[model samples]
Structures are given as structure tokens and as C-alpha cells.
Target: MHLSEQEPSSWPQWLSVYHKRALLGGGLLLATALLWPTPQLTTGQRIALPLDLSSTSTHFSVPDTLEALADKPAFSTTITTGDTLSKLFERAGVDQQTMYKVLEADLNILALDTLQPGNEISFYLDENHQLMRLEIDFSLARQVVFTQVDGSYDVEEIQKKGQWQPKAVSGDIYGSFYTSASKAGLTAGQIQRIETILKEKINFARDLQAGASFSVALSEQYIEGVASGDSQLLAIHINNRGKQIDAYQFSDGQYYDANGESLVRAFLRTPLAKTYRLTSNYNGKRRHPVTGRIAPHNGTDFSTPIGTQVIAPGDGVVTLVTDHRYAGKYIVIDHGNQYVTRYLHLSKTMVRKGQRVTRGQPIALTGNTGRTTGPHLHYEFHINGRPVNAMTAKIPMASRLNKAELKRFKSMVSQRNIQMGV
Candidate 1:
């Protein structure tokens, strides 16, 4: 019977095709069998099924060999600002599955919502398609791991203690601090930190001369032969115009000037000449106006009308300048040694990087840009990479003047106080 003779649903599609072809061959086969005489020895001839043979069953029983797995490279990338957890994983060459596993493994320790810039994620895979390790370089200070166990991962944190090797170098400010420091084999981070340490007492960023001399004794950190981070300022000295200021990082983690005075003795000077209207006070932390997020506000804010000139609190080199959303326009000055000063929320920058500026010199024009509600100058003073409240900073009384200069300043103070009827 032909398959088409039956209903459409009678048999499967594949089976219907086979059955139709079989029927077509059956008529020819019947004719051949009748035309050709029934072959003799038919009793001895018998159809044999492949499975019916014992050897066939044994031969098919052998399984095919498996292929060896390939090895993968361990890779990681540091996170930058405006990065999300998903983006971080992609840069590290990980898929969504791995990212999900990593998030689940250390939900508390590695919160996706709290991830910061400069963090690194490292991936580890085995030949068996298993996630052997999911590591994170948190703050470049430690490595956190998530190890697989029976298909599930367990979190384990490992602190990496970096190695520090003391190095000493000297260079003159031929053109700029960065160029001069780089020529001496110093990284950008190191150069920036040095500017921050000495920003308060000296103003190299804005006042650096072409022939300024600087000497630094610092600890260079190494993680497998790569410079990682710095700890303390072992020693630093900067000489300009016959004035030499030195700072030493003591064993107790305090930075002292060569005169044994604290490098952090005073607050960052307000760059604006007139403190007309105080816009923002020195707070431990403040919210970024543009980002609308809580961040440490390292400086004080002075408000004034637009076009008001801004001054340099200390001598330093202009390191960075940009028109940021919140800061509007900002300038960074690096003081010789490790002191750095930052002036933000400006309408214009009067001075550029590598330009020498003196204390009270015009560096910028006041206005609102970054994280501001009005026009003001945001001033910051950093020492060893940490922001200090500029308002409460107590400047060490300008060194006791020599007898003659002391008498002169005393008379001046007395005369001024009398003139004001104090």
C-alpha cells in the first residue's frame, strides 16, 4: 500500500518518504524475482543482520577517544571612572555567566553598586571549563578570590603586601615638574604625590623657576617588578631663590619639614583675594553637584561674582587644566617635594601648567563649574594624597622673624591694630 493512500497524519514525514520509495522498488523487485529463476542454494543462503553477529556488537562497543583541553591566559584590567561592573568584566575577557557567578560569590564584599574606579578584576579558567578563580585587585592593595567548589564558588580574601625599595633621585625643573620627573624615571603618580606633600609650604606648580632644584628620598614599591604604590615620603628638599624647604617622613608616619616642622602645619591658603561670600565651608565630605553623590570635599569654597581673579595659595606648577561639568574649569599646582594644590570651579585659568607663580599671584578667575550651586573658587590642599580642610588649617606663625624683621613686623601689626582701633 502507498503511504499517500493513507491520511496525511497516518505516519511521520520522514517515514512517509521512505515508505513511498520502498513501494516504488517493490514492483520492479517482484518482476526481477519472477524473470530470473529462483536461484539454487537458497536454503544455504540466508540474510544476515549486522547486530546479529557477535563481532559486530564487540566492535561497536568501543567508545571514541576524547580530545584534550586547551589552556587559557590569566588576564585582568583596571577599572576607570564611568565604568560599570558589566563593562569591567568585558574588559577582563569574562562573560555574563562569569560575572553573575562572581557577584553571587562575594555579594557582600564585592558589591557591584559600591565598586570604585581603579579596581581590577582577574579571571581564571581551567581545562575542564571550570572557573577556578575569580580575583579582584581592590585598591591595588589586596587581591580577593572566589574559588569554585563542587560547581559553586566560595569567597576568600587575600591581602597582598607590597615590597618597597628606597630610591633617591635629583633633578632640576628644566621646563616642568612632570617632564623633569619623568626624565628621572619617576611615574606620574609619584610626581603628583610629591607635589601634594609640599603644596602648602611651597608653591612650585605656580611659582616653579626653570632652574629649581629638588631632591627626594622615597620608597619605590614593587609587585613582581612593577611599581605599585608609595607609603611615606622618606625625605624631600626643594631649593628656590636661596630658600630651601625640606620635609621628612618620620618612622611614625608623620611628615616634617627639614626644620622638624610638620608639613601639614597650616591650611591651604585661599587663592581668592576677597572671601566676599563664603559659598562652601570646609567639610570632611560633600556631595558632588553634578554627580549628586557624596564625595570627600578636600577644600574650602569662596564665592564671588564672575570675573573675580583667583590667587595661588602656595607656590606650585600648574599640572592639570580642564573644563569639567561640575568644576567648570580647574587648575592643579604641584609644589616641589610632595605638596600639591588644586583650585576648582573657575571661570577661566590665567596660568597654565609649567608656568611659575608666586603666592597671591593671579592663577584663575572665580566661577562655578564642578559641584557648585553658585560662582565660587574651590580650593584644596593635599598632603601625601589626602585632602585637608583648608579653613581650619593653622599656618605655623610665619617663623619668628629675625630680631630686626620681628621688630619690624611687630611694629607693623601694632600699627595696623592701632589704625583699626583694635
Candidate 2:
């Protein structure tokens, strides 16, 4: 008998064998897929899962490590023209005590008080919803952070000297300097600063004439190809009736002419008429007389009788006149060009906030108001918010540059002039 005739009944058994092998292979594949472990997501990695909108129970969840950050409380706001630090803190739900602590930390740096329009500030809260960190972005290149350390806050500033792109604008004095400068793309603030810099030499309201030419040299700061809106005034020039007045910025941050003569009035080195005995000098590691611990004495102390007149060291606007537990009654004068003077331990403050005082004007009276042993005066000179030894640190008494300094300044001025297209 042939094999084709004999296999007719055995066809079902052969077919069963093929079916069983197919089923076994399918089972192995399904088992392997179901038994495999899912790889975990690394730090900063995220998983995006498609959602079925029609389903009710289906949901997405973040990793456990990221939950804390996602749940943490945070607040941020941009400072406006009338924005204040206290009000901003209140909106962030921070208590006044914490705000005061931040202010106290700002005593040395004074960064918080200098908040300007368009600056951003943020506060981060911990698990307990208490402020843990605060950040202020002053500009694209400047940032300040305050972090809670123990019972106080530690301040750290991150600043970058970004590339500055030079800019120049020139115009004819049509009506007023302010109008002409504004037409030439100078801001109101910039115009005001220029007027202030050249106030001693040229009076824009009185000396500037119509049809006279004026030019400004400024720099627009850039960070990573982004405009920071920070315009630096490099130089200013005005030609009126054939008389030329120039003010060029120098490395010392003061403005001067090509001859290295200061553009502003001189600062009075001794604010008082008569000399007083020096009781304590500025010491970074001085032992505190009250606490008996290592503390930094940021200002010089002079022993004077009560009611001794305290005069302003320079022409400036009084920014603060307030009382403090440790500092007592103090007056802060903000002299133009990054200079500041403080009179502390005063029994009385003669000037009010926002009052402009002359170089020799009375500002306060010395006394033992604070935690001091006797009647004395605590005077401090600050440059860019950091206190220096006024007794030894270089004071700007309308400084006339020396030979070497003048040469360097003239060279710098020439370069700036070319950049300004003058």
C-alpha cells in the first residue's frame, strides 16, 4: 500500500502536533513580557504616558522624588515703579519677623533696598510652608540669594560682568535738554544722570542753548545674546556757544573730563568742624563691647559730647532716618556716584528721609543712644554698600588724577570717544 493512502486517518494527529507547538511559542512570548521588570527613571528624567480622556480612574503620577518640589509653596513677583519690599513679602505670605531678618542680613549688602522696576524676586517655602530661600534677580547678570541658616539668613550675590555693546546717540538741542535727549533715545533717568554728572560744569537748564549739539556714550549690557536693559553711561558731551563740557566715566566709577578733573563737588573728609577723639576704628574681627563676642565693627567711632553736631560728608539725599535696637537712631545719605555715608548713635536726626543735604550741612547730633558706654558718634563711609575705613580708605575730595592715572584715563577716554562716534 502507498503512504498517501495510509496517512488519511493520521492527518488529525499530525495537525494536533503543529497546533501545540504554535501555542507553546505564544505562551513563552507572553510570559517573558509579563515577567520583565520596568527600568526606573533617572534623576531629572520624566515619563510621558498617553492618557485616555474617556477613562475616569486612569491618572498620571510624578515620581516620588519630585513630589516634594511639586508640592512646595513658592511665590514670585516683578517689582514695579511703586513696589515695596514689605508689601511684596506680605503678598508672599511671609511674616514680618522673617522680613526683618532678611532686612538685617541686607544691612551689610543693602541689595534688597535697592530694588528697581522690572527686577524679579521669589520666595521658596519648605515642608512647613516657612520661607527657606529668597532670590532677587536684579538683572540678567546680577542675582542675590538669601538662605535660612540656623535662625538667620546668609546672603550670597551672583554677579557676572557681561559683554557691553556700545551705543551712541546725538542730537541738536531743540527746546530743552530733556526733550532733545529723549528724542535721541536717552531715557528720562539717563538724562537726569547726565545732568547730575555735569551739574557743576554745565547747567542744562541755563547754559544749554538751542541748536547746540550734544552726544552721549552709553553701553547696553548683554548676557547670552539677551538684552539686560542695563544701560551704562560711559560719557557725555555738550557743545554750547563754542564752549564744550565733557564728562567721561573712569575706572573709579566717577566722571571726569579729559584733563582728569572731577565733574562733581569734593567730599568733605571730616564731617565735623572740630576733631574728636577716636574711640574705636573699623575692625572686621573686633570683640563686641556689649556681647563680649567676636563681631565686626563696620564703622569708626568717635568720642564726642552729647549734642555734638554731625554734618554731612558730601552732598546727597538722605535715604534713611530711622531707629534700631542696636544701631539706635541713624541717618543714611546716598551721595551720587555710589558713595554712602551713615551717622549712627545719634540723639537727634536733623534731616528727614529724601531731604538733600549739602557737604557741610548738619545732619544729626551725637549721643549714647544705642548699646554704647558713653556719648559718641558712629560714622561709616560705604562704597557700593560695603563699609570701609573712612580714616584710611581713599576719599573722593574732588580728586585730581596723578600723572600716571591721567595718562591711563586719557587713553580710555579716547577709546570711549571713538566708540561713541564722537
Candidate 3:
């Protein structure tokens, strides 16, 4: 209809209608937004969630392990010069109080007071640096253990079981007996015993030739499948320039020949039981070491370590025990047959004058007490008050074993000889 000309009066009515339509359209738009579909999550999609720390219900705690706290480390050390047990313990981080406690726990700990070089000791410490265990090697076969038990120390002595294994070694002398014997795996103690067994029969320094040979059968000690340093010589044979000298260990712990004769002679060549070098011979005219003047050196000198045991050459009475200007601390033994043996430069005299001593008995200790430049033993032999060379002079032999003892010794010798393949 052509309302433009007639709608002036009806304008309010038309405006009201238009307002009602606008309201209806706004309501429809609101409903459409409410009913619309949203996007959905896929099956493999991941979503990072935020932590909710506001809850007071959750808690965590760590569990303790007692085994870990009980473990400890062990320390081992060898005793050296001037090293004491207290110092050694300190080096292992142990306190003096604890060491003293352990030491006072038992009387066996007294052995540690006599410690020497080359001894070994071990320590075990806990996490708190407290000494838990201590082990000391008293010898190759003996050990002592101090353990912490119930907050106190307890001591125990353990003796190791050792096996004795027989060993045979043979060698020929090229330059010196010591050199050749060492090359054949002979220990120093073994070599010394060998020399002593043959001392009465052969002069090692003079009688040993280039081709002189020796054989020894010994028993070596083994502990826990390891070789220990203890040994015993069972038999020895020396062949010097086609002369054979055999010695066997009898039940009496002394060496005897195959004919049941004692290997110990009437007089020992030197006062020392161990092997040593001859520093000076019995010379009528020679230059003295300390004085540097020509003099009659009436005695033979043996170079040895200080404090080595000086043994009696024969059974005799001690006639003189005095110190001299040239001879330091000297001892003179007088045998009944116009024979006398003198030992000079002694560190200590173990015997007093008028005391009777048997052959091979310790009479003194070697030292540098006299007018000498070094540590040695000056030994002199006199026959009817006349000085003679002890090394080359004729020396008598001790009486052989009695008939019954000889018979038993012969049987033992036969068995040992078969074992030694002699």
C-alpha cells in the first residue's frame, strides 16, 4: 500500500513492531550459541596436566639401611726401623686411647713390644674411624688377632698349620761358595748351616776349588699353599777335589757323618757359627789396619756382622776375660792339651773366667770394641804358648759316638742317604 503519504500518524505503531522483531532475533542467536557442537579430543592425543599442590594429605620418607653403615676398610703395613705400634696405629688413623685399650685387654699383646724390622701388622677401621680389628704376625706360623666384641676388645692367638716339603738343591763353586749357593736357591741360613757342617773337614776359603760341588736336602715350610721363610736342613754332601764329605741330621739335632761320627771337630776353624770372610790371615809381618805399621799379626780376623754370636771352638775353661788396648773385649779359653783359643773384639762376654764351656757353646758376641777399623772377630790359636795359624794348623778331632749310639746313627744315616739319593 502507498503508506508514505498516510503513515505519519501510524509511525509509533510501526516502530513498536520493529522493536519486537529485534528482540526475537537476539533470543534465537543466544540459543544457537548454547546448542553449538565443540571439537573432541583424538585417541592418541596427549594433554599436560598441572600439579595440584594444595592437598595436605600426601607425604614421603626415605628408608635406612644398617648394612651400609657397618662396612669398613682394611689397612696393612710393615714395621720399619724406629716404628712403634702406637705410631703405626696413628698412621692408620687410629687414636692412641683405642690402641692402649686394645693393648691392655690381654697379656698376649706384650709380644708387640718386641717388634723388629720386617714384621707386618694390619688394622680394620669402621665408618666412624674406630679401630674394629687388629692383626699382628708374630712369626711365619703364629699370628695374633684383637677384635672388637660387644664394645670391648678380645685377643686370640692363631697358629697356622704348615706343610713341610722336601727340597734338593745342588751347585758347583765357581768363585765363592756363597755366590754359587745363592744362585742355586739356597737361603742364607741354609748356607751357614752347610758351612758349619763341613767346617771341621774343609777350609771353605782355601779348600774350595773352581769345580767344588755341594748337594743339600732340606725341608721347606709352606703355609696356606704359600712358601714360608722357615727351613730345616736334613742332609748335606760336599765334594771337594774328589774328596766326599757327607753329613746327615740325626735324632739329636746334630749333624753326623755316614760312619756315625759327629761332624763337630775338636776345635772350630772360626769362632763364628755362620759363614764369614777372612779379613786378615796369621802373618808374621804385615801392615796393621788401624796403626798402619809393620807388625806381627798373630791372629786371623773374621769379618762378620756386629752382634753375631761367637761360639767356643772346643770344650775348655775360660782362663782370661779382660779388655786390652789393642784387643777390645777379649776371651781366652784354655784346653787341657797345651792348646788355647783366644777371641778378641767382643761386644759382650757371655762367659766369665773359670767357667767351663763346651764346643759350639756361645761365649761372646762380635763387635768393633777393640782397636779395629770395623766389626770383626780376632781369633788366635796357641800350642804350648806358641802362636799358630788356626786355619792350616793340625787340629785334633773329638772322640766319636759310643758303639751303641753309633749303631743307631748308622741306621738313621742309611734311611736319610736313600732319601737323599747319596
The candidate scoring highest on TM-score is 2
Ranked by lDDT from best down, the candidates are 2, 3, 1
Off-target runs (Cα >4 Å) in candidate 2 are: 1-63, 66-73, 79-93, 115-117, 286-296, 303-306, 317-330, 345-356, 366-376, 402-405
Model 1 agreement with the true structure over 310-392: per-residue lDDT tens digits: 88776556767765433457788766445667777788889875776766788888876654677777777765545667666
lDDT of 2 by residue, 1-422 (tens): 11111111122344355436546767664344434432311101011223233534323322233233323324566777777777666655567777776776554455765687888776665423466677788889888888777666767777677888888999899899999889999997688678767777886788777789988898888999998776778998788978888899899888898789987688877678789999899988787676565546778899999999999887877888887655678888878677888887899999898786888898888888866878899888988656899898887767788999999999999988887677
Per-residue lDDT of candidate 3, residues 1-422 (tens digit) = 11111111122344355436545767664344434432211000011223343543333211122122122123466777888666666555566667655654432123454467877676654433456677777678777777776555666666666999988898888998988999999987577667756776788888888898888888888998788787778888878878888988766555678787777556777778888999999998777666455546778889989999999988777877876545678888876445778888888999998787888999999999857889998888987556799999887565577888888888877776666666
Candidate 2 — what's its lDDT? 0.72
Output the better candidate (1/2) by lDDT.
2
Per-model TM-score versus the true fold: 0.44, 0.72, 0.46
Residue pairs in candidate 2 whose N, alpha carbon or C atoms collide under 3 angstroms: none
lDDT of 3: 0.68
Off by over 4 Å in 3: 1-74, 78-86, 94-119, 124-133, 138-140, 145-159, 264-405
